[model samples]
Target: MNYLVKINAVKTTNELEDAWSNEDYKALLARFEYPDAAQLKPAELKEYLFLAISDFEPHEAAAILLDYKCSDQLVDGQIDNLSHEMLRTKTFENYSEIDLHHDLFNINQLLYSAYNGKFPLGTVNLVEMEIKGDDNVEELTKETALKALSYGLSENNLINRLLSDQIEGHKAFPEAEGIVWELQHKGDDVYTLTISEKWLTKTEITNPEYECTVVPFEEHQEAN
Candidate 1:
């Protein structure tokens, strides 16, 4: 019998200093109400952004963060006081997760509290995964795993699906488990798959879990 085995995945957090490069700066300035926002230099841009985001009420600031694709990310382990202070308070209050290593830093997972009512930005994307009941785990790929993690952590996914049985309790607090997956793609994009000894199995969100371990895995591979 191939009952699924499980391993530990850590919830690792990191900050990307250049997540938004000079290329992004132009688009960022374009959306702002500031007429000269696009013309601002480094120093001027920082001043303008800081002013625009820093002063609004918590809810408004959250909108700007998403709408503007704000540069800041929430992180742990000795983060500077100034940076934390500058980030919108609602993000932390409403809560979101951080994807440490990827092509682009996925900022907020839109776990926005409904206290402010829903908006267009409330929706997020989901990555698919196929769970099989066997030792033949070749179906799972690194790319697929990464996509699953992102979708699982997303507000829409969480609200829709209950992860308590998969990990410790989706984004298990205090006692976090590590998730690891790898895949090698050939001509047709099929994966040469390798994952942690324990793989993930998806569960329905409607089920109320009594004591499920919905663990949020930490990705060790960084984007090259």
Candidate 2:
């Protein structure tokens, strides 16, 4: 399931538009290599902002901000600013990591770039797992397909050992309907890659902002 994070508490008309109106984000589409990566249409700019800002549970995000430990920056257990907002987001259920990867891939497709260690795990999943999962993959670039295949990730997963954290390198996951190649990366790439395994099984919501029970993927579909 994917997270449906919503801003909580009282709502104001103005609210926060920083993410909604940010223009600088458009420049970031370059990594994906767009025809006009240097310039973005207004609609495109605002759309990407929502994704960047919308990610993360409010409390989980807040904890990383200044004065979170002391609660100085928070007002009444909440921060209004999106960056460090204490009670900014309340997560609903049924958001798929697969969907998140797909959505983010759609966004990234607008840009021009190559995937590497620096790419977000979401982006990596886009180039790696999601594309392969497609029933009809008409065409995939050699470089792109090679990079993804080398990672040992299968569209499906196997569980030879339950709850075993041992590093098995690349092995087939039984749950995977067919061949499975495990994904492993070093350095900053780990942030997104490791999350695939470590993330709360979509069952564990240790983070206060995320809820255990959730919604389905279709209900919260955003405009494409």
Candidate 3:
């Protein structure tokens, strides 16, 4: 089920817009601050402004911010609202990290980057553990992985097609699917996709002429 967040107040619309245009996150926090309350410092204000303008639940985000100790700049009391004021305040930026081995900490980095456009600092040590209790969930079997490889692109998820290709190519032979695409925040784009071939089956495909009768592939049907 989808959750809803309600923000009831916008004390001064003009001030909010001005802050957004200038990317003045500190000023934005001060604007949203409760009257006669202590102001947040610049570092703390950056995170609070990000949380306030985000689409995520304010409380949930606030919890993360507090965990990160970035919540100190926000105002006290119940926060009930969704606003784009924060996004409008900053330009989109790209950040990436490459780790030789995967770790749970990597997931945390993804979480931070996805939500806040910031990367974590320092090295994250890892310890291996045996995880259990996941039997209820169906695993992505070979069949499902193979099928996904043949799937085509759609407006909804242009990135999915790239994944599909990589999985198919991998099943056929071993090769890295890294360097999936060159991302751009503007202009026409080109996407490079690779899928493992370990997943493909040699099946005859019947292509019909415009006047002939036939059913198109599932991918084509879905796209239409």
**Which candidate wins on lDDT?**
1
- Estimate TM-scores for all models: 0.30, 0.18, 0.18
Best by TM-score: 1
> How do the residues 15-84 of candidate 3 rate in per-residue lDDT, one tens digit apiece?
1111122234444444444232236554465456554535555344433333332234333331111112
The better-scoring model by TM-score among 1 and 3 is 1
Please give the RMSD to the true structure for each candidate, in Å: 15.3, 19.2, 19.7
Model 2 Cα lDDT, one tens digit per residue, 5-76 = 221121112111231223345433332223463465676664543344335343332333212222442354
- The lDDT, on a scale of 0 to 1, for candidate 2 is 0.27
Alpha-carbon deviation at 212 in model 3, angstroms: 24
Write the number of the candidate with greater lDDT, choosing between 1 and 2.
Answer: 1
> In candidate 3, how many Å is residue 47 off?
18
Candidate 2's displacement at residue 175, Å, is 61
**Model 3's TM-score against the true structure:** 0.18
Model 2 bad stretches (over 4 Å): 1-12, 16-39, 60-85, 88-224
Model 2 residue 215 lDDT score: 20
Steric overlap count per candidate: 17, 26, 21
How well does candidate 3 score on lDDT at residue 189? 18
